[model samples]
Target: MAVSLFYRTGSNAKEWSGTFEELERKQAKLRRASQRILERHQTQDGLSEDDVQHDLKQQQKLDKSAEKITEYLATHQEKTGIKGKPVKSNITDPDSAKMITSKGTVQGYNGIAINDDKHQIILQAQTWGSVGEQQTLVPVITQLKQQLDKLTKQKQPNEHTIKFTADSGFNSEANLEFMAQSGFDSYIDDNQFRKRNPLFKESETYETEQEKRRLKRSKGRPRLFTSDDFHYDEATQTCRCPAGNQMWRSGVNVNSYSQKYTRFCGYLKDCKVCPLQHQFMRKPSIKTGRQVQFKNDESRQKLSYGDKMKVKIDSPIGRRQYGKRLGAIEPVFGNITVNKGINKFTLRGQEKVNTQWKMYCLVHNIEKLRNSLH
Candidate 1:
């Protein structure tokens, strides 16, 4: 599993802590490794000039790495895993080429805060070198699950399943499917799905008329059905079209907001033969209008539930719940960057970086526990 390392601000402001003694130890190790590699490449007659030059270049690279480690430690005075005194620096100054990572770039370090759904306390906190929240969801949730498992062993028996609540950032079809299969309950948004409501007038009168004329020009094609084509006789629970045609009913599905809707679709032949065929055959000319047709079963289910979820989330109670997210997760980063003063990573390679990240997370959790006791 990928580990999360939390921080405030961006990558340049992220904090990691080590002593001057530890830096010296790492420098010595690098020197020894370089010496060994050079010795193995030497000839029996001593050393060739070419071999010597290669060794020099290798040594220079190692030396540069060591220098960066030293400079990082000196500029920040905090002990490992502890918050430090803040120092002012030229925030506008750009990082030199030497400071760039292997990816040949520096980007924002997004702070992620995963909280316990029950208590609203932050469970896991970490920062990512990448921007956007989609990639961070699984790793953060996994870490939070681990913490919850440990906490559950010491708490009540009834609390077993883990529930997560996140904004639209963590809401993707794949993520939702993963959470459902993992035995986790999530209130993730269906960001891609747009609800179709006839009451909302989005197109202007002139634009609507222009669209109607365009549809009239394209005849003998697949006709599209507007909301006007279907009439919902709620008293009889049946749908009829303006051309005196009955619609085929596919049972009702209940939505998240307690609104249930019955789905109805018309036959292709009935639509093609009708006077409305011209309007239905032509694709909608309105660039931003919602389609009135039910594309699929999943889409039909989403029509009612998706809108309710959006409405509920925008309510006062939902706003209060969402407000807790920033507070719960952001401090883990502030402690690491502003408090601990760890800016750039000392290690290279993905595995090494991951190990370093896990260590940072451990330190953050310990700090949280320590502060809670006080």
Candidate 2:
């Protein structure tokens, strides 16, 4: 049996943008304004009592709004153990976090579901408040084990070997290791798994040179020669430009993204005298020279999980097994969210949201059971 999972997002109840300290400062300013309004009622002979009372009432209303903000901060601060910039928790549904969907950025809960391959019956469902779905794999598998253990005590269900498949989002080294240690035949895709397949060899089409020139014209900037326009020789540690000029190694740089590169530049005299300088190279003479940066391979090979998964997932048998992942789990989410109209979660807290998620999955499984009986 193929066991698979995917994420279904929930809607947000409210939104908050700033930090807790900023909220507290606004509350303090409101209190001071309220005090100043009452003091003006006692003094300032030109002012009438009615005007002073009206100002006080307006300030009081603002103070009440600040009070509500303070209460929300207190509740969320206790709930989320970690706090950092662009504070994550929503004001109304404190348990939900900000997630990016196809529509836009949404403050919501991530609903995870595991389903059986035979009839697409949901076996387990969980809701999480994390932005990324990578860490949710372990918890989903643990719940699946417990649910299957309970079923053994109830009755004799179909006995079949369990197989797991998921998308690239769940393709970390630790996750792959845990799946192996748990003794399951798992087929998880890495980020570039499909690129490794021989079937996609001719799928990549490059932009025409005329199209590239048109883009340069629209941008209102002179076309600069990029690194891809140069040819590198592995046998001889050197690089040559499109004009057949050998570029000398200028400098080495360690970038912020943990990648190393060697910068190459042509001779100043050669760049200044070349006819193609304005066409391919930087036109300005003060600009050092035609520069190109080549990335080193050391930092790239340090992580092997991507390469390892690519080899496994590119196999013929692996493709056949993983093809069941989307059909197995995605229909369960579509049935609950689209067909059954349980798209937006009505609960506020984490525990309540999780219960609602499970209830929807249960309803889906019951419908599957009813169809099988007929």
Candidate 3:
């Protein structure tokens, strides 16, 4: 399966005005007043009888004025037309402007499109309010699966697991876990180290010579357990570590990417105190806590798979293939943003925005169908 993602540019309307220093002064005044109340409360012999009534009234008046000033600032901060003035119009809705970016903005709904392998046609499309592509992976995957299932019922007799591809923005521990749990074959790029050109590095030249010398010596003892040694068996609900130790169920299940998983820790506490704590614990903070904490072999096993996926995505060939993600997904949004003239949102709230996005996806699909037929 081919994958793409969509992002929208944030509105650049001038919504707030006033010097940074001026804003800081207002905040400081609030803090000083708060400290004064605390100090008076802590004075010797408890608060003076007369001071108590006077202080309470003073505090109440100050709080009331502060609340009014905050409301005024929010309601009348800056006008959209002026360089530093709040908009005087009654339109408080944020989604009314045309979305624009360095790459050009979509007029209506910002979205991405994906094509399934069976037919080089749009299989999945979605639009979102935010500009970040990383958050869109799981949702697109879910939509792709649903679309595939629908297509299979209508045409093919056999069940097939869909494959997805995207760039590094979609990389994350959570997204990788989603891919493993869903059992989708994906070739997403490893965005973290993609910018490096190893040929240009001096270290590569030195390492080449050093490796030849090292190969002449005998290999050292094998690691007790690499992360690869642990396997998460979802069916049996257990993690078998490389050393033949079973990491059984521990309390508390963490839900991530719409999947539920119970944590597991090794019963062999002897392994915990080993010098390889860094490898096992991963995070130094976790090591400081009780020696035994919630650990899931499935999560661990999934992590190993994720690492391999990262390696594949980081390869030169992988980067070239994954770069197609931008081309594949972006034009779908361009059609809506540029052709349709849908810049700002007319709706409010997440549910409405999501509905708006779905409509845009439907429109994109219609355009694709038209293009295919002609």
Candidate 4:
């Protein structure tokens, strides 16, 4: 229960990592091989209609994926572009997303829940096919309203004053806009919430190997400079160090996931005896100064909703309500994932897994009711 467990009977990481071309080749090969088997069975008049139907259903899924990829290629010719990645299809479970959990990469659905503050009772629980929890907020809230209506045998009041607090995963401009109009007291934290809070200023993060070694060398000195400390000029193709010194282009086309960055390093002449060498701290043996990478700038759009929500969540009351989020919502998942031992779902696809998650939530609420009665 401490680690994520993946059921490898249907698919694994390797099976879901193929590119579009590889998927087509493998899919064709499977079809040909299956066709031969079916033909052989039909020759003996022993082929089952049920088996044929299942084969056709799987073929239809493969066909649909091919069409989707073809349409993507029509608009976007490049395979490795940022807007879209090479299609990753799980033949076993096409609806599942490639999720990066606390353990590692998992080919499964993301589960979500809405819990009441008082009783920690789940108002709604569902599973999404996508890895991003940001997209799940609106759908869950909309579904919760319907559930409440059915439970009460009437529509809930427009101004129910229900308090809603969610972690940063559910924070977005659109979601914040929805929360603003939902007639509920809501607090949703941004990803930088902890860092922005003054209380966490002393917290240390060893994000790089150099940082870890530097921390040991400095023995609890303030954190060293990072990529954010430097600046890159796209128009001039230049980089500036933290000390406002010019740095040379040490490397180009440094790949990080789908994005490319240009690396710049401080000159040895300027850095060896520089007073702020710790700013670009590197190995003691290396002659080069600190290094950094940056990509081309993308235009920023005005997010009125985000700004409004930020102010709302940064208020004194916002801190207290959002603080309650962990105590109210997290324990329900912990009880199911750890105590009930449903950390890794046994089922595949969104619908079945969603049903399974709701059942577990139901069991959790039943436990709460039983404990209250006792």
RMSD values for the candidates in order, in angstroms, are 17.5, 17.5, 17.1, 17.0
Global lDDT scores for all candidate models: 0.48, 0.66, 0.52, 0.63
What's each prediction's TM-score?
A: 0.39, 0.61, 0.48, 0.56
Q: What would the TM-score be for candidate 3 when compared with the true structure?
A: 0.48
Prediction 3 global C-alpha lDDT: 0.52
Q: Top model by lDDT, which number?
A: 2
User: How would you encode candidate 1's per-residue C-alpha lDDT over 158-241 as one tens digit per residue?
Assistant: 221233466676665456544543434334544532221212365242146754675477441323445543434444656544
Tell me which of candidates 1 and 3 scores higher on TM-score.
3
Better of 2 and 4 by TM-score: 2
What does candidate 2's lDDT look like per residue over 1-374, in tens digits?
A: 34333344555544453356665676687778777777776687687778767887887887787787778876666333323345555666666777777767777777877777889877777888877677889888876777776879855333224667888887887786556444355678876666655466543311446645665775634344556545554345576554445678877674736777877888777677654576455445565778777777643323243444454455455677788777777777678878998777776678998998888888998899999999
Instruction: List where candidate 3 sits over 4 angstroms from the true fold.
Output: 2-5, 9-113, 117-121, 127-135, 154-161, 196-306, 315-320, 339-346
The global Cα lDDT (0 to 1) of model 2 is: 0.66
Stretch of 10 with least lDDT, candidate 1 = 90-99
Cα-based RMSD of candidate 3? 17.1
TM-score of 4: 0.56
lDDT of 4 by residue, 1-374 (tens): 00011221213344644456776676566656656656666675655799767766776676666555455445543233223666465555666666666666778777777778788787777776665677778877888778777877896653324667777777777787666555555667877777655356453433456766876887845445666545455666776543445678977878877778778887777677554465358444165677777764453222355664555555445566678776777777778868987666778776788787778779999999999998
User: How many Å off is the CA of 366 in candidate 4?
Assistant: 1.1
Q: Give the range where candidate 4 is weakest over 10 consecutive residues by summed lDDT.
A: 1-10
In angstroms, the error of model 3 at 259 is: 33
Say which candidate scores most in TM-score: 2
Per residue, candidate 3 scores C-alpha lDDT tens digits across 1-374 of: 56655444333332322233343355457657866876777775477778887877777766655554465456644324313433232122333234445666432334556765443456666665443456677887777667767867756422213346766666766776556556544566664454443434554422475544653441421122344434465676655432223456665567656655466666545355433334344444332321222234435434465575654444444455556655665565577768887644556544566666667667767877887788
